[model samples]
Target: MDNRKEILDELSGLSPRLRDLKAKGDGLTTPEGYFEGLSDQVWSRLKDSPKKETVVRPMRRLWRLPYKSGIAAALVLAAAALIWLNRPRESAAFDLGALTPQEAEQYILNNIEDFDLSMLVASRPEEIADPAGAGRTDTLDSELDQLLDEYLEDVDDATLEQILF
Candidate 1:
């Protein structure tokens, strides 16, 4: 209780000093008309000073030509690589020399439907035509058909089953 009463007495004592300080108005002063002519003085000073000229040199585009071309080439190569990577490539032609006779025969039999017999006959005009110059002959057609039937007849049941299934 005594501590509180002492604090209150101290604060009351400082109140009159604070009022006196406020009445004295901080005791600082500026030169007469200092602010009124400040802008004009700054403008006059700027006007009286010598102006500085700025010189700008033009950039040489030729200097960067190689670098720009190199970047463009790299971008083109990157695009080409991306296109190559994404495109669907055709399977390479079969290397006939690499296949055994049986393998070649089997491959031919498997893809027999892909061949056009009519086109083959048409291409080999002399082969099927009569040597006597007869326009065309049913005998050659019958012979070719018989040869194909005989060839198929020679194949075993297992080979035929494999080819079919």
Candidate 2:
């Protein structure tokens, strides 16, 4: 084809040596014994090179593992142990039952600002939920009123007004 001729002419113009090789119709060639001792030549170079040797400790790894893999496994085990050791335990749990009723009530009253009405109501028994059913509610209210009256009597007008306002 005309295209093939153009490519051939372009290649021949680029390299006259390529044109001569094309006429000869031969590619690369070597002498008859050029590769006869190729394996021996490679082995001679290998024999002159240095080799590395590594010593392994039997106690380093549980199984016969390589150095990097064994160290990774040991790190994972150490991390797991640390997490398990620091986790919360049932034996160290707070003993809610250990607190007596009076002690619990005193604690609640002392920290009353931390509690809301819903929380106090929910913690009370069903009978106490109805103030009419619990005589303690009336008694507590009267005691609180008496205490307030006694404190107000001791305070002068300005201090009482400041406290109220």
Candidate 3:
């Protein structure tokens, strides 16, 4: 009538039934290494096979970087050198005909009071009746030619007249 005794009785009966079913199947017949000959045949076929040959070609040519940028740099440097070599040299010799700074300043200061630049600025361009006279035509022509040349040479007319008159 106790509950523990009832459960133990049911489990003890189930163990015999499981043993009887295992005995009826193939689990009761075989032992180890039943197929040893089949394994030997497979390994012998793999080891006795032919080895493959790999063909490697000797490198006939190697790839390299292009030389165009280096060539362009060298050409530019050579052109610059040629231009510098062919340039004209400035004159190094001296001449005494030019006025010095002190001399020019002194001359301007000494003659400033006697000249009137405003009168020349207001004067009109009147043509000489005859820019030539007896026996003085060549002189007049030469002077006139010099004057015309100076006028056409782009010299500042106002500054020139101020200095002259």
Candidate 4:
């Protein structure tokens, strides 16, 4: 409350001086009709000034040449890569005439498990016999013996024993 009273007293002391200053308004003043003629003055100045032409040239279209070619090259490379990656490889051809006796024997031995020996042996005799079954057993036996001898010539005793057993 005391602070409010002191503020009121100070404002009262300055009241007369504030009234005198207010009666003699600030000396700053604009010329008569300054605002009304501002737009017209600006227009007259602009009309008397010389005008300069502004020309805008179009940009060159060659800037994207390298980028376009690079994309085309990338696409071509990608296509080539895909074609190379997906191409079929030629399989190695097996030549019986080119194989050595040992190679042939090894191949036969390795693939022996693929044959069904029991089924072959159990086949009907009629299948083995020709239209005439009489007096042909000797010839067949001799041919079989010859073939067996030739096949067993290169085979070791142990392998033969294993096959026989």
Give me the candidate number with maximum TM-score: 1
Q: What TM-score would candidate 3 get against the native?
A: 0.18
Model 3 lDDT tens row, 1-165: 576456556646878565555435665554577577768987788789866676444332112235556667788999999999999752211211143645433433444344333322122112233444333545434543554464446557785677567
lDDT of the candidates, in the order given: 0.61, 0.60, 0.49, 0.59
lDDT of 4 at 37: 94
The window of 10 residues in a row where model 2 has the poorest summed lDDT is 90-99
Better of 1 and 2 by TM-score: 1
Each prediction's TM-score versus the true structure: 0.25, 0.24, 0.18, 0.22
Q: Write the per-residue lDDT of candidate 2 for residues 53-158, one digit (tens) a residue.
A: 6655666544554567877888999999999989985321132125465654455444434544444443445436776757765554454455446655776899
Error of 1 at 49 (Å): 45
Q: Note each model's CA RMSD in angstroms.
A: 25.2, 17.0, 32.3, 27.3
* Alpha-carbon deviation at 16 in model 4, angstroms: 99
As a whole number from 0 to 100, the lDDT of residue 87 in candidate 2 is: 93
Task: Report the lDDT tens digits of candidate 4 across residue range 40-94.
Answer: 9999998998677764443333336766787788889999999998998522123
lDDT of 2: 0.60
Tens digits of lDDT, candidate 1, 1-165: 897566556656878576545546788999999999999999999999968776444355433767678778888999999999999842212332355656545544555555444643454466456566433435435544555576588879987677667
Where in model 4 is the C-alpha error above 4 Å? 1-124, 127-131
> What ranking emerges by lDDT with the best candidate at the front?
1, 2, 4, 3
